[model samples]
Target: MTNPYAASGVDTEAGDRAVELMKQAVSSTHNNLVLGSFGGFAGMIDASILKSYDHPILATSTDGVGTKVAIAQAMDKHDTIGQDLVGMVVDDIVVTGARSLFMTDYIACGLLEPTRIADIVRGIAKACKAVDVALVGGETAEHPGLLKPHEYDVAGAAVGVVEKDKILSSEKVQVGDVVLGLQSSGLHSNGYSLVRKIVADNNWQYTDLIAEFGRTLGEELLEPTALYTGVLNKLLQDIRYQNKFSTMSHITGGGIAANLSRVLPAHVSLDVQRSTWQPQPVFQVLAESAGINLFDLESTWNLGLGFAIVVREDSAASIIGSLRELGVSSWQLGVIEPKPENAESKGYLSSAKGTHGGSVRLVGEYAK
Candidate 1:
C-alpha cells in the first residue's frame, strides 16, 4: 500500500514515535486534574473546583521563548527553553492574581530529533510540575522545508483561574503603596536578542561564560525559570496577606519601566530608587563589552529585577520578611507617590533622590 502522508513529507510513523516520546516526558508532570495524556486535541483539566466560587475569572496567555531560542540553539541547550516558555505565559496570567490551572505547548521544527524533542518536553514538564500546573496536551510538527534544520520555535498557552472579585488591576493600586522588587535569575528569557549581539560582538562564547560559573553555559542559561507560583500561592492563602498585595507586575520584555507601569493606577506615580540594588555582573559585562547605553540596559534587560509587588507601605516590611523566609530574594526598590498637579499627566514614574547614580531618569527612560 502506498502512503500519501509520507509523500507530502509528513511521516505518520515519525510523528507517532515523537508523540510517544513526548507523552512519556509529559506524563511526569501530570496530577489528578489532568484528564488524559497526549491523545487529545485540547488539554483538559478538572475545573469542578471552580464551581465553589461565586464569580470565576478565566485568565489565559500565550507567549514564546522569543530570541532566547537563538541563544539556546547557538549553545545547543534544549532543557530550559520549556521553563522559559511556561514562565512567559504563566507570569502574565499571575499578574492578574490568577492561579495557573493547566498549560499546553506547541513546538514546530523542520526536522524531528526524538532525543532533542524529548529534552524540550522534559523541561516543560519540570516547569509545569513546579507551578502545580498540569501539561494537558501539546503539538509537535515536523515541517522539513518551512524551518531551518535543527531550528524549532516553541510557544505555549496557559489557562489560569481567579475569583472575579480578587483580580488584581491598576484600580487597586494606591499612591502610598510600596514597590517591592523580586530578584530574577539573569534575563529570564527576554532581551536575549540584545544579549546575543553583545556576546557575538565581544567575541564571547557560551562555553567561556559558563566556565566562570563553574558549569556549562547551557546549564546556566537553561536554569529553569523561577516558578513564582508557589510563593505567590502561599501569599494569597492568607486574607491579611492578600489584602496587602495591591498589584503585581511580571518584568519581561520592555523591562521594568514598561511592565511596572502597566499595573500602576493612573492617579499614582512610582519613585524607584536605583541605588537600592546593584546590577548583576553579567549585565555589567554585557553593557561594558557592547558599549550599551545605561538607558538601554534598564529598559531592555531586567537589570536583575524580574518581578515587582505593589503593596501597602505599612505591610512592606512583613511582606519582604515573608518572601525572604521562603528563600526568595526581594527588596524595597521604590515607593508609590501622589500624581503630579496636571491630572491628565498624573501617573508618571520618577527616580528617587540619589538613585541610579543621580542619572536615574535618563538611565531608566522608556526605550523607543
Candidate 2:
C-alpha cells in the first residue's frame, strides 16, 4: 500500500508513535480537574475552582521560545526548551497575581521524530507539574515543505485565575516603594537573535568554550529559564506578603527599563541602579566579544535581573529575604519617586510594547 501523506512529507504513523511515547509524561501533569483524556478534539478544565473567588479574572498569555530555540536545536537538546516556554507564558500570568491552572502547547516542525517530540513534551509536562498546572492538550504539526527537516519551534499559552481585588496592577506604586531586582538564570530566553548574530559575526562555534561561562557556548546558552510562578504563588498566599508587591515586570524582550516601565504609575518613576548586583559573566563575555555598546546590550537582554518587583519600602527586606530562602538571589534596583516636572536622563526607556505608562531611567556605574 502506498501512503500519499507520507509521500507528501507528513508522517501520520510517526505522529501516532510520538503521541504514544508522550502519554506517560502528559498523563503525569493531569489532575482530577482535567476532563476526558488525550486525543480529544478539545480540552476541558473544570472551572469550578473559580467559584471560590468573589470576582475572578481570567488571565491568559501566549509566547514562544523565540530564537533561543536555535540553541536547543543546535545542541540537539529538547528537554529544557519546554521549561523555557512555560516560563515565558505562565510567568506573565503570574505578574497579574494569577495562579496558572492549565496550559496548551503548539509545535511546528519539518520532521516528526518520535523520541524528540516526546522529549519536548516530557519537559513541558514536567514543568507543568512543577507549578501545579495541567498540560491539558497540545498540537504537533509537521510542515516539511515550509520548514527544513530537523527544524522546529515551540509555543504555548497558559490560563490563570486571580480575584479581581487581588490583582497587582502597580497603580499602588508610591514615592517610597522599593524596586527589587530578581536575579536571572543566565539569559532566560530573550534576545537570542542578537546572540546568534554575535556568534555568526565572531565565527564562534557552539562547542567553543568561553572561560567565563565555564561551559561550552551552546551549553551556557541552553540553560533553562528559571521558573517563578511557584514562588510568586507562594508569596501571594502568605499573610505577610499578600498584596505587598504592587508591580512586577517579567523582564523579557524589552530588557530592564522598558519592561519595568510597563508597570510604573504615571505619578512616579524608578531609577534602576546598575551597581545593585553584578551581571552574569555571560553578558560581559558577549559585550566584550561583540564590541557592542553596553547600552545596546542592556536594551536587548536582561543583563542580570530576570524579574522586577515593586514593594512597599518597609516590605523590601522581608521580600528579599524570602526570595533568598526560596533560592533566588535578589537585590534592590531603586526606589519609586514622584516624577519631576523636568524629567530627563541620559539613559531612559520611556515606553515599550505600546505601553505608555510610567517611565524608568538607568543610573549608576557597573560594579565590574
Candidate 3:
C-alpha cells in the first residue's frame, strides 16, 4: 500500500523513529513527579507535591528561539538550540521566583530528520535534567510547503510553582535596592535578527573564523544560553537571601532596559553603570560591523548582562558572594533611586520614568 503522507514529505515513520531515539534522553529527566512519558496525549506532572505549600502559585512562560534558528540551520547544528529554547522559556518562570516543574517543546520543520530531531531533544533533556525540570512532552510538526526543507523553528512552554508569598514582583522592589547583573554566555538567543542582518551586511559566513571570538562566528553565536536556574534555585533555597531579594529580570528582547523596566515598581528607577562588566567580544564585533551605537546595541543585545536581580542594598554583597560560590560571575551594576525630576538620561541607562513603570539608564564607559 502506498503511503500518502510519506509522498507528501510528512514521514510518519521518521517521526516515530525520532521519538524512539529521543525516549532515553527524555526518560532520563523523569522522576516520580512526572506521571508518564512523552508518548502520552499530554505531558503529566504530579502536582500532588504542591499540597505541601500553604498557597502555591503556578508560573508559566512560553518563548521561541527567535531567528537564531536560522543560524542553527545554517550551521546544521541542532543540539544547542534546544538549550536556548529551554533557557528562553524556563528562565522567564524563574524570574517569578518559581521552581520549574515541567516543560514541553514544539518544533516546526519542513521535514522530520530523525537524527537532527533527536539531537535537539537531547539538548532539551540535558538542560531539563540540569534544572531538575521534567521534560514532560513535546510536538514536532513537519511542514512541507510552509517551510524550507533545511529550516526548522523551536519554541517551548514551561510551568513552575512558588508560594504566593514567595512570588517575586515589582511590589517588593523599593528605592535604594541594588541591581545585580549576571554575565551572559554570549548573545544568549536574542537579537539574532540584528545579528543575522549584520552578518549578511558584512558577508560573513557561518564557518568563517573570527579572531576576536577565537572560533567560527557561528560557533560563538550558537553557544548555549547559560542555565541560571540551578544557581538561582540554590539562592532561593537558602534562607538568608530569600526575603531580601525583591525581583529579577531575564534580559531578552528590547535589551536590558526594556526587560528590567517590566518588573520595576512605580517609584523606583534602575540605574545601570555601563562599566560594571566587560562586554563580550561578540557585542563589540557586531557593533563595529553594523556601525551601531552603544545605546542601540544595549537596547538590542544583552550587551553582556543576561540576567539581573533587584535586591535590598544590604543583601547585595551576600548575593554576589553566593553567586560566586555557585561559580556564576556577578556584580552590582547600579542602585535603585527615587525617580528623578527630569527622569531621562543618556548613556547606559534608559530614560527614567518617574514613578509608574520606572526606567533604566547606563552611565560610564563601555568596558572593551
Best by TM-score: 2
TM-score of 1: 0.89
Best-to-worst lDDT order: 2, 3, 1
Clashes of 2: 0
Better of 1 and 3 by lDDT: 3
Question: Model 2: per-residue lDDT, tens digit, 40-67?
Answer: 9888998898889999999999999999
Q: Which candidate, 1 or 2, would have the higher lDDT against the true structure?
A: 2
User: Each model's RMSD to truth, in Å?
Assistant: 5.0, 1.2, 2.1
lDDT of 1 by residue, 1-368 (tens): 87997776666677777677777668877888778656877777888979988999999999998888877777788888998898888888888888988888999987777777878888998888888888888888988789886889999998888998888887788777888989888778887778778777877767775434567554555555666776887787767686788879888877676677667755566667777776665666667678776555777888778888888888899989999998789998777776566533433443322222111121233212
**lDDT tens readout by residue for model 3, 60-103:** 99999899989989999989998998999888898999999999
Better of 1 and 2 by TM-score: 2
> What's the residue-level lDDT of 77 in candidate 3?
91
- How many steric clashes between backbone atoms does each model show? 0, 0, 6
Give the per-residue Cα lDDT of candidate 1 at 164.
87
